[model samples]
Target: MNDDRLEGAGGEDTEEHLLRSLPGCIVAAVGMVGIAGFVLFLVARIVRSLTT
Candidate 1:
């Protein structure tokens, strides 16, 4: 028999999926920021080295 307790199943599933994915999203955002920072640092170092 079909389950009655899971009424509005689509919305519930979407909410649960979003909750599970939230951490991965945060990690991805942080990783992007970190990579950007590192690239900037490398570029600055290269520029400084060339000038010197």
Candidate 2:
């Protein structure tokens, strides 16, 4: 919002830092869901195999 803030040499990296971290954050969330799904699938397969 302030001009001095943006022109300053090393005041902040808020936007850039957020942009940089976005991909890693997304990957981590997706990876967690993927792992959970895989585990559930494995459990379902094991249950099916045991029942039949």
By TM-score, the best candidate is: 1
Compared with the true structure, the alpha-carbon lDDT of candidate 2 equals 0.81
Model 1 lowest lDDT segment of ten: 1-10
The regions of model 1 sitting more than 4 angstroms off are 1-9
Worst 10 residues of 2 by lDDT: 1-10
On the 0 to 100 scale, the lDDT of residue 52 in model 1 is: 100
lDDT of 1 by residue, 1-52 (tens): 1343354365666576667668989999999999999999999999999999
TM-scores of the candidates in the order shown: 0.69, 0.66
Top-lDDT candidate index: 2
Residue pairs whose backbone atoms clash in candidate 1: none
